[model samples]
Target: MPLHPFLSKTKLYKFLKTICKPFHVVFKYTEFVAFIDENRNKGKINDYYNKSTAYKNRFQLHDKLLEELKNKPIFYYEFGVAGGDMIKKWSLTNKVETSRFVGFDSFEGLPESWENKKEGHFDQKGNFPDINDSRVSFVKGWFQDSVYKALLDSEFNEQCVYHLDADLFSSTLFVLFQIFPKLKTNDILIFDEFSSRDHEFEAFEIFKKCTNNKWQFEFIGAVNNYRQVAFMLK
Candidate 1:
């Protein structure tokens, strides 16, 4: 039996996007890489890769990614949930049973600069769009000063997944320290803008330095959007 015309096109496009988006990114990245090489662009292609959705979606594979962290009571705690886009998409794809996702932000805008890099998208504070998920909540505050002290109550300590997209060294370190006690060997941690930012990387390094190798860490899959890294905690 033939499907309705509207449903067929919708399904077809969904299938095509799932199959072709990664290829599109790789192809575009190859071209961008070639352009940089030919013009001696001095790593501008890196920035281009950071802005690609193909790369971002690769990091958002919640089904496989979250399944790897399924033993404990999981909580997807995100530092910055702009428009709740990633959370929304992840909820659609993942088979989460005991996981609750919490997104924290100034939502207003980024906090004052704690590092050398002076550019970020949240220059002015704004309100988040209405969230439809029962499991997701947006907390408004700066993560460094407020997130841990304000929100880390009895309920949040039971989380297993922490996505640190705080975009500042202080906030990243804050999450590491504040959340460290709650992290079990089965937990997973993700840094949404860590690879290019040396300061954020240093936070992870410092955390690792203090832990004496009790926690096992790995960079999962390929580099996504050039900067974000999904790390599986073992």
Candidate 2:
């Protein structure tokens, strides 16, 4: 039922928005849980889910990606490369010199507070990680930068593995919308903080709703209780 005309525009609703602000996160979380329940059963469910830490599950996903690609040259783009441990692992896992690995990070730290992590929580003093890989490079700036613009104008002729670890709803949504158009069949997409209901998970659900592109995916299984998950564009 629709709200009554008077209540619809009442200041009481505005007041409630201020007083009930904290529950907003809880509501978002609940919505995300429903999303997971709906989509988790799709495609394949690898046996490793919910049995290990997220870090280990992440490498497991990476190894699976390489195995599927047969270690071929590909494009790997990682958003939120704070200390770059995961990106570094990806570089070494695929030794193809022609494979390009690009990381996007402000390096200053988190642009905004996320849960218990305050702004600048992951501050690196603006230094890039020392990864000695010829095919690897860094885009040192916000996710919405020249690199994003370049991506908008670029083409991905080879297989692309996009790692969405931005850990913020705004950042994740920005990257998803930007790349949603360029995604090709069989391209891989990974989410490091996939279970963060108010962040990555919420963003993913919203992105699916807001886009008219009719993007379809192959669920490549989630690990660590859906904290780390992988999907394939279809």
Candidate 3:
């Protein structure tokens, strides 16, 4: 075996990792800032709104999105349904009997530490959401364990509205990769934490690149300082 490969499997590698750990956050953040600058004009978005007074109410942007979607039947997939608020809103907003809403989350919280939140920060004690609507349902467990299976069970070619709010890079990217192929023209993608540079922002940029120009999107709307954004496939 090669000496370097052998050493990499040893405890010294762990020791080296500890030494390099502190720089990881700083370097990734610097790269993120640079990424934001380079891609400032690259996306199709032109307008942005901050919503300073009611920064948390993203329903405003959702209402505007209704214009683009024209209150049509929605195949809405929400990746992170923490308190079940958004699902309820969508269920009530698009009452087209054909519209279906699916929410996915571990209900056990963040899969790993991101930003200032601990790994189990969003945990709901494994208690699933209670939504009264028949059109709404949820997939409980980590994205890796639940997403593919859910897609396999459901069939859809309708324009999908993917609300990626998983918070962590891994969760967000997994949903994007799985759903990107199933998306149809005019399908909408919404990012709840798009400004989390090292997490959601990074995954989205990577996802776009991986598609290799196979996809084109019109940046449609934004809320809360681009923290939440919508895009429509062309």
Which RMSD does model 1 reach against the true structure?
18.9
For residue 172, give model 3's deviation from the true position in Å: 0.8
Residue 207 CA displacement from its true place in model 3, Å: 1.0
lDDT of 1: 0.62
Model 1 TM-score (2 dp): 0.63
Task: Give the candidate order by descending TM-score.
Answer: 2, 3, 1
Q: Itemize residue pairs with steric clashes in candidate 2.
A: none
Clashes of each: 2, 0, 0
Give the per-residue lDDT of model 1 (tens digit) for 1-234: 565687566678678678988887676556545533543322212333444456455444444465555454567777777677666655554446655777777776555564554445564356764767676677777776567664546364454667787777777887788877777765667776664344566687778888786687754532444355555677
Tens-place lDDT per residue, model 3, 1-234, is: 456875576668788788998798788777766744544564434233333525455677777776556478878999999888888778877888888999999898888998999999888998878888888988898889889989988757677889998888988988889987688888889988887877898898899899896777677766655677788888
- State each model's CA lDDT, in order: 0.62, 0.81, 0.80
RMSD in Å for candidate 2, one decimal? 3.0
- Model 1 regions more than 4 Å off: 1-73, 95-98, 113-120, 154-159
Query: Candidate 3 regions off by >4 Å?
Result: 1-54, 68-70
Show model 2 residue runs off by greater than 4 Å.
1-11, 18-27, 39-54, 152-155
Tell me each candidate's TM-score.
0.63, 0.85, 0.80
